[model samples]
Target chain A: MTGPTRPAEAVITGAGLAVAGYAGIADLLGPVPADRDGDPLAGLSRRLGRHKDRATRLALLAGGRALADAGRPADDTPVDTGPEAFDRPGGRTGVVASSNYGNLDTVCGTVDAIDAHTYTGASPMLLPSTASNVVASWIAITYGMRGANLTLCNGATSGLDAVHWACHLVRAGRVDSVLVAGVEPGNDAVTGLAGAPAFDGAAAIVVESARVAAGRGAPVRARVGRYARRADLRDAVAAVAPGPVDLWCEPEDGAAEPPVPARHRLEVGAQLGRRSGALGVLQVAAAVAWFGRHPRSRALATCGRGGEASADAAAALVLAAPEDRS
Target chain B: MPGGIAGRGALASTGRTAEDMFAALCAGRSGVDTPRAFDLTRYRTRHAFEIDDRPPGGGDVPMRATGWLLDAIGAALADAELAPDLGDVPVLIGTTLRELRSAELAWRQHTDFDTDRLHFGHALRERFGATTTYTVTNACAASLYVLGLGLDLIESGAAETVVVAGVDTISESTFGLLDRCYPAPPEALRPFDRHRQGMLQGEGAAAVVLRGTGDARHGLLRAVAVNCDAYHPSAPDVAGIAAAIREGQSRAGAKPSDVDLVFLHGTGTELNDQAEALAMAEVFGDTPPLATAIKCMTGHTAGASGLHSLIAGTDCIRTGAVPAITTLQRPMDEAAGLRLVRDTVSGADIDLVQVHSFGFGGLNAVALLERGR
Candidate 1:
């Protein structure tokens, strides 16, 4: 009880994983479907019908898993998705979803319909969902988390930045918990459309304040402390998590790591794909889930993209094993 | 972790720079005109505000929003006197349709398929060498939230300085949706008026440079808050919108008495105006803040509307003249607590400005701006 409150150390009480044609973290490594190319949204038949676009489905699946992993209900008691309709553990829960290409399939498709025929040709209903917030809105509505709904699209930094944002809000005492989702639903057709083979899949995590997690005695999957500018493993990592630290980040961001005497390695980005804003969170969630079985080791998830194209864009999320509950 | 609005630039149908745009609005120059973004011959009404300026050899490329974004960013950098090389500076851009117009061309034509959606970020990063570029598209409120995110970046030490931009180009689908959503005789756009009919479709792009207190030049931002209704996708709940407004005020530590002006989202739609009125009553109590809906001047810029409103708020704080809502000849009957600005009200000692932005599907954001003190 007598330790400095790590500005960035929030407990990752729950984690969720979902990719194209998959349901939740259970199916993450269960099996690769023989008909992988077949309809990726067959499981969502009862939940959604016509407008179940790729981005929306990915958000829902990942969000559902994250909620369940946190020991919350998959769906809130059917209530209005309004401010008065929802209740939160700490009165506020935010969802920040990151993406570079936001609902592009519907955007391009609607534009195509308009071009091929006319305004009357394209579905008016599909036009509104083109906004990137649709993903965050769908996630909040389905889960009934009503703190905030924000969507950030800044290449791969989008995912990690969303994490930083959630951390900042919780630290600021604005929200009690945040459900962060990094979803792009990557594919060849989409990557080809974007002119890069850099993205595919979705990942989510439930981040609550260290005080809240400690109060409820929820087993902390990992602790992310105050976000330092340079992920110098020494200062950025909280004192409470002092141990032999291992850095987990994508290959692109490995170039910036300081020569800290710790086990530095790459985890999810390489296998997922490459060059995506969603990698930041995917790798963070991947590392959190990785530590589920292998406790005692500290893992810091970092990712970045900068230079000739975007301004200096980079972020890092520190995760470490919790102190003994006993 | 408070931040300041260092610099700003706007490119709407009315004028380009802040001074020019404000001058046009003060001179009663409305940007509303017939549709030039697309052909609306068969629609009920085809009124919209479309920009006339084009980049050199423009329309030659599939992505037209690129040119507008570049121009706005360039202006913002110059206005803020920031260096062109944005090393370690995060860039946040907001756009509902990054380049849907380009997609329309690629779809109908076999030879011109170049509607690449992800090129906006790459193009800016390569040209400007930014830290990172972000695109936020939460419909009309995207730009405001993007600005809010910029504040988060500075507060979290992600970047000492950040550039926020909002850009949206009108296309056939946008005009079509606007035509159907508020199918009224759109000779002009009117919000908060008793006879208010619909919002005109407008294309606009704007940018602002935000920095910590050390770098803030013109004004300071007390707080920025955004939340979702979890309500219907198309309809907004008055209670939800009011809750967001109160939360933003609480975060800013500002009472209704501290606010000198309020920039209503004022989309000119009936439901939006009424909800905003009810929200004002809930927040300001008996003494409501002076309100102005500027869309009647610039029409509705959609995603870029928030930036436009922020720009107008900055002018109000600096010049001490609140631009009045022009189309409010017959104000809404329920707007008792709202001090509507019907004409140019000047010579007021304005300190704090509260701005509201709400989008479809229950996305709501409110930002509080204070004159540098």
Candidate 2:
């Protein structure tokens, strides 16, 4: 078998985050106060937010911010309004979201309702939320994005997998740009299942092809570098990183430390609390923020249920500052 | 640009193996029966297409869907002449409800349920040594979406072989939702029928092995196209479905006339069937290709329904036999010009086939398959 070739590169143009104690990507670089209480859905209209679950609300907030930060008009804008609306056509932008326990509360509630009152008693408004893809669908519907929409509920690596697929979509020319979000709500339902509090927030990144980014004059925060998924963390690190990186965002529950050397190592879960689905995207967001502070540097983000006997393959991704890319 | 379909497998109410399911479908067998998985005394619709063989209790497996998925994967690997351990080959499984049923059961019975089992990665790794696995929850269009992603992986040289599968068991909550939505439960799932009431939920799993360089004994995946309507959450959009079909044909370098058969996403639901039929008319003009809906016999398998169609389409390409919608009493008005197969057609020159799978969230996916050389 031949080795997989490096995929066509895409650049991260904008990043948005709404984790607890942090409002955006820039806030990740400093200490998060314990008592910060800003509303993630501050700007969302009640009409649009009606019947939306917590995960969907967080995704919408983060997705809208990312698009705005990318210098793109709101996706809800009328397509025939003007030429500026054509710059970020709804038909060309896609959404890829990851959330493992995003809809557990809705599912549990619906099941309870059905159990108590039968099918006739179930709420019609909650019917759509039963499907796991509700988060991604809501983002697309809110933003009027008609491109390929996907939701990954994959295990621990889902967040990074969303990023990988988002970049793949851009590189494959399927979509001009993609909004990738990783969200998980720390509700009682999810807390009970997780045996601990979960991350009650979301993180989003705007990924587009280099040419499209250049054409749109969107600032390149970081270029998507090498990515590899292998059975062993060492193999994945070897495939993605050949030299030392400036920073490494390690997985919180990963059993073994990554073998690759790095100048600094950061753990996302250490600062944000227990995160299952949002860890990977948060890592990428942190890398982007770190790159802003230190130009011409590279960062590696790795995630998976490593060391567990039944855990699947580990994933590693390398991100480079825009100026560092040749 | 096409990935070779090295092998395929399926487990449904109609049959176990892919070949068995195809034979049953050709024989006009219906798997719909009284619901056994859950209590449906209050539901107007009590029938569901459920697998009879139950997996034995014991082990760390979370739900019956996992058992079905593992069995289908094993069957596909065996058919493909590959090692039991997939090693580095990535596995992508699509579904609407992963293990939500298990959660429901636990919540109702107050039994201890491990939340870790909600995802199938651990089980897949432990059973098949599959290091890479992705569980995509794209609703009903999931399996076909993963099939498209598998093609991209192979075409991009990411992997020489990739396994794509779809599995979903009857979630009581989903069944209840459908029950409330339907005005009345029809006797059976009648797709494209003038009096089609609605669709019944089914539990099943299907898998297909895709190879970049290998003998494609089943068929070649010519192209796949996916798009979101972004119009409505639950309603199907004519424009989105039409766009997917046209885009798929364009990517496959084929015209509407070149398609020999079309596997409709006929869910027997009023809006879904009407919207799909209109989309077909928009894409194929006055004369559409020969079309059939397997849901009539298998009772919409939810997420696995798309792959169920693909498996049947592959069999048609291999055996030159096309199954008919035996339950269709009267074809709907929307599909007036299109040819809806009513009786089994044998020895048909079916080379190029198109499969459509649409889901809630207005997710539409279309895949084109060509006869293997």
Candidate 3:
């Protein structure tokens, strides 16, 4: 039988997050003036086409900041149709974005348009944006990331799953670096539909392979260890060392909550107000920020449906400070 | 390269099983008909490729998309000889549209919607006893993306077996958007035809069982690759699509000439057809292999379209028969030197098959499958 992987490490070279306390992430991360709508788009609205939806705006805002934080070029936009126009050097940097209730607000709007007027009255632009992948493509174009891009719309676990995939690809050497992000728009429709009052926010991490970080002289913030997946967290939790650990658990509605003796456990639902996809990432950002000081702590983040055997989706990730492994 | 497609099944508008769908494709039969499952009185387009609502285990009840899913999955597991428990296998399903019917019904009935109970993953996990489940929603190319993820999982030694599937439905929202986007279609959807008008959106579901090729249980899943055009939100980038196809071929250890047939994305829209032609030209040059765009018969099944194409390609290698385009009357200038099959051909001596799926927002995926031993 195989033991758990020997702690392959990647560092958080840069990070960006969108939170409710700040009306707009761009508003907080910017010297650039906010546009007429009072959200700092970094002058990207005009370039990305006006009438950018809330999800689109939030995605690009967080993505740009992540790129900028990583010291990579961030402001390029899709200019032409030809392939030559998009050719760039950071071609190996990929993007894996996650959204649980993906742009459903836009779909609701399209349905409302049909209800208000005729089907033809629906905005042609609105239909395309409804799919979650649209935001990932724009992020790739805006940052000139030509590597593999995938959008994960797998309900609550979307964020951590995207990060997990990013780690896998980086560890596998398929890509040098990846822009891993999770986004959820704060809207009444999603909350009403999901029955969880998920707030609006996005969080992104710039996870580069240890080689890439070392080559770039980037500081290592944390290391992500091997993940275990199961229908129930019972088996998964048993595998991890019992201790005070930072936790982000979105248990199924009636399941008894798992215990976290750690004082630093993030009240993810309380902090983000039940944001689905962005919840796990919110915990990650908070944990990474906390571990920066401790430098010897570990954080356990879990995102999935329920504790029941029928839950079908459950993922547990181990993230810690660089020195913890030693 | 570690992923091997062990078993496959499909439920398309054209036919139910993969064999039946391939037969219908060769026979030039279409399942496209008027939409009666839902109220589309508000939309201009009245026709769709709606499944008959009867699904395995559904027991005469209207299953909608869920029915189609269980039906395809039932066949796939049966083909793979997997029992009911599925034994800790991961079920990764790709779907573009979720059934808004329940959410709409909840709104009408004034009951709180428990998304937990209603999600397809919950249903599959309950019925099939699967432990790991994922619902992929990356737009049109979601199935191949799910399959590609399955490949990664097996290659990374995460799972020994995986059930990858894709499903979507003919619903009010789909036709409404298609009607507004491209108002008119000249009868049957004629993909890759010079006189092609637009696409006819269809619905159904399909599934393929995958295991690591080290077991050599089925056809080798040579490569499954995904790349972004990052060019446009709706239209695909020719250069990006071309690059993804070439990259997929290289990873599969196959040359352009080695590929016996190609199941093109062939969405039938003017720009898509043109862009695909340009993309194919960039990849295969003058002597591209036999090309088939069966969307003319099956209609585009949205996210499930990739699995439909993958299953169809698998049949081509098995039977050594190239299914016909069925709706192509004229070839474009870009398809000048390529052999576009319009009628079914038997004994083609096929080996490798390359399937392409390009979705909204430039998410392009390519899968290379070989004949199973």
Best by DockQ: 2
Candidate 3: how many backbone clashes? 1
Q: Can you tell me which runs of candidate 2 are displaced by over 4 Å?
A: A1-8, A75-88, A254-258, A269-271, B55-62
Q: What would the per-residue lDDT of candidate 3 be over residues A67-160, giving only the tens digit for each residue?
A: 7777875756545445653345455678888776657676666666776676877788776765657667777777777777777766666677
Q: What tens digits encode model 2's per-residue C-alpha lDDT throughout B24-116?
A: 999999898888766666588868898876555521224889889999999999999988798678899989999988887776675677777
- Give me the displacement of residue A17 in model 2, in angstroms: 1.5
- Model 1 spans > 4 angstroms off: A1-8, A20-42, A48-50, A77-91, A186-192, A195-201, A225-277, A300-318, A323-326, B41-45, B55-61, B108-120, B152-159, B212-217
* Model 3 spans > 4 angstroms off: A1-9, A22-49, A78-88, A239-263, A269-271, B38-40, B54-63, B100-113, B117-119, B183-186, B214-218
Candidate 1, residue B365: CA error in Å? 1.6
Model 2 residue A147 CA deviation in Å: 1.3
Per-residue alpha-carbon lDDT of model 1 for A177-279, expressed as tens digits?
A: 8898887766543554555664555678888887777777667777775343222233233312434455555434355544234565654544445536567
Which pairs in model 3 have colliding backbones?
A: A186-A200
lDDT of 1 at B335: 83
Error of 3 at B324 (Å): 0.6
Better of 1 and 2 by lDDT: 2
- Cα deviation of B39 in candidate 1 (Å)? 3.5
Worst 10 residues of 2 chain B by lDDT: B53-62
Q: What shift in Å separates residue A92 of candidate 1 from its native position after superposition?
A: 0.9
How many collisions between residues are there in candidate 1? 25
Question: What's candidate 3's DockQ score?
Answer: 0.45
